[model samples]
Target chain A: MKEEIIISGFGGQGVLSMGKILAYSALLENKEVSWMPAYGPEQRGGTANVTVIISDELISSPILNSFDTAIILNQQSMDKFEPKIKPGGVLLYDPHGITRAPVRKDIRIHTVDATEIASDMDNSKAFNMIVLGAYLKVLPIVQLKSILEGLRKTLPARHHKLIPMNEQALQAGMDRVK
Target chain B: MKGIHLMKGNEAIAHAAIRCGCDGYFGYPITPQSEILETLMEEKPWESTGMVCLQAESEVAAINMVFGGASCGKKVMTSSSSPGVSLKQEGVSYLCGADLPCLIVNIMRGGPGLGTIQPSQSDYFQSTKGGGHGDYHLIVLAPNSVQEMADFVGLGFDLSFKYRIPALILSDGVIGQMMEKLRLPAFKPRATEEEIARDCPWALSGRTGMRPQNIISSLELDPAIMEKRNLERHERYRKVEATEVRYDTFMCDDAEFLIVAFGCAARICQKSVELLREQGIKAGLLRPITLWPFPKKAIEGYCRQVRSILTVELNSGQMVEDVRLAVDGKVPVGHYGRMGGIVPTPEEIVEALKKNS
Candidate 1:
């Protein structure tokens, strides 16, 4: 099973981090994974994106022209990545910053109000985790338990206390998807 | 065996250096490779393994520090991008002249000047060929994966110490920035002073009064002596080329067309090979793990079978020259590349292969 995914948003929106977490979870499941971010000046408050691929077989290339899943959190990303999604692919978006909705006939499009939910929960930092939860709900590519373990591995030990809150945010995101 | 951990290629190199008992790292910050120094700083290997991680004033100073550390028979290293690596060429040459063992990592980016921070293999000529003055060769290793990024650190150090020659990890920005699952090598302890003395008797370690004074100098005024020294270095290089050439072949047994690449370009070509195979084309890839050695013998072996050779790189075409020399007109050789840090897509590579064929 091979899954190629793209996650994109503004630099501070945790787009790259979400990809990192998914890559980590894939590693926890003993899967081969690669996470490649569009780095350089584009990372400083500009639109940033990452391509993540998880596979049971060896991964040939980390860069790709198309993806099976596109998790877009900003309007610019949506505009840039919508056409790059494969037919019958999954397009998940957070409707907060997106001005244009994704318009594609051959793909499955899902929306989650991740920003509003994070704001309502008074934990705006969990915005990316919530979006990740929505994507996981749709794909279930990796187990939720592995994701929690991934969080433990990624977040510093000093920030371990916030894992429960992040887990809650993830669950909230999963629950919000109808 | 340690379990797998997800890590960026740059971070993996830093961790691997520490685990491999690297005595010191000196570097300046540069895009696409700043993470190497940043990771080393964050880990504070000095506090844990007694490793020295210093942010030098400039790339030149950093490489000179490597020279100083290597002179003392220490497992020292420095990392930089293309432009920064340009600044370190003089010191690299000095290390080569002194026959000092050190690791120099060039996570290459677009160049000629301060070109761009994106990934590029433009430094192939600078790295494999001599970047600095004089006839010298650095043992260059190209890593295509984050796991190889980690593994090559130890391997590079081992080969450097074994040959008393500097080794280079000639990677690019993509391999430096990308994250992937890797199993780190087991931790090895730093060599003790006695071990260092025993291994590197010519080191600049303070004389114990038992042996004659060990002088570390590359300067020689006498023409005959200099020529003799040059001969000695050339002999060592010949030995390296004979015994240390390394490369990997993918689906080359029955391939009609072979693509030659290294580092990130090689990874992309691997994908392109798969794509071409799906189209009923018998394409293959030959990736040189050691760039300086060029894997010429392996390329020669494949040239007898493959109808044509296509060399793909992130640069305009540097390694293609080596491939051509290896083929030696046995087969037609072509090149495909993108300059200014533009990576060619797999589809583009496939198209180039078909056109060249």
Candidate 2:
């Protein structure tokens, strides 16, 4: 099984990291994976996007014009990527700052109020984890254990202290998917 | 031991250089490829493996430093993006003329100038056609995945030493910036001083009164002698072409249409080939791992089977010329590409193939 996923948002929204975590989890499971990021100067404050392809077989191209899943955060991403989602694919997004919702009827669309949810939790940085959780809830391609392990492997040692909080955020995201 | 790890291509290159017991890395940081130098600095291999990693003031300085290390038979390398690579061309020519074995990685960003920081395969002609002056060819390797980025460091050094010529990893921003699962090669400790002395007797390692002083320079005022050396260098390159042609083919036995590309463009073409096959169009891909040798003979061999060919690149159209020359009008060769950091997608490649065929 091959899943091509694209995540896009402002630089600080953890779009790249979200894709990295997914790719890392796929790798940990010994699945073929590739993660490509559009993160040059745009990584400073502009829109940053990442494409992660996880496959049971060898991954062909990390760069794709369309994807099986798209996790879009900001409205700019929603505008650009909503049309790019493959027919019958999944579009998992946060409803915060979205002036216009996805108009596609063919693909499965799920909205998570991750920004509001993280705001409620008083941890703005957990917003990305919440969105990631929402994605996992919709398509549990990777096990929760692998996600935590991937988080451990990806985050620097100084950030290790925040894993429990991040875990809570992931659980919170999962809960909202219902 | 093949250790499994997930990392960006740039990071893998750095880690592999360290793991392969590279003696020195002298490079200036450039975007898309900066992590190569950054990872080396962060690892501080000097503390662990005694691998000296230094940030040179400029790309020219970096290449010259590589030349100095390689002259002493040290496994040394330097890396840069497209424009930065241009800055080191003079040094590259010097390295080639002096017959030093070293690795030079061009993590190509778009441009004839400082085009873009995004990934592009536009440097094909510059890389494969000898960007530096004189008739010299740097053994060029094109890696599509982060795994190859890691694996090619050791391989590049191996070929460099084996051929006694400089080698290049002609990568683009996509392969340099992307992250993927890769198996790190087993750690091979750096060569000992005695081993260096014994293995590279031609090195000017102080001469030590054991033999005549070894002069290391590209200068020979005599034009006839220089022409002879050029002829000799070409012979070495020819030997490499005969022995070191590395390529991979996908579903070519029954293919009627072929797509020729390398590196990231080849990766996309691979998907296009699969998609075309799904639609009942017999398609295959020929991905050349070594770009310098050009895989001319392979393309020539396939001409008997395939009906038409499409050459995809991130450049406007460069390698297509080489492909056309290789096919020699055997099959109608068409070109499709996206320039200035615009990566062509698989769908686009499929369309291009359909239109071209």
**How much is the lDDT of residue B139 in candidate 1?**
96
Number of the predicted model whose DockQ against the real structure is largest: 1
Candidate 1, residues B118-213, lDDT tens digits: the string is: 999999899888999888999999999999999999999999999888999999999999998888989999998999989999998788867998
Interface RMSD of each: 1.5, 1.9
Cα-based lDDT at residue A86, candidate 1: 95
- Model 2 root-mean-square deviation: 1.3
Extract clashing residue pairs from model 2.
none
Model 1 chain A poorest 10 in a row by lDDT: A38-47
For candidate 2, the lDDT comes to: 0.91
Q: Lowest summed-lDDT stretch of 10 residues in model 2 chain B?
A: B201-210
Candidate 1 docks with a DockQ of 0.73
Best by lDDT: 1
Docking class of 1: medium
Candidate 1 residues lying further than 4 Å off, grouped into runs, are none
Residue pairs with backbone overlap in model 1: none
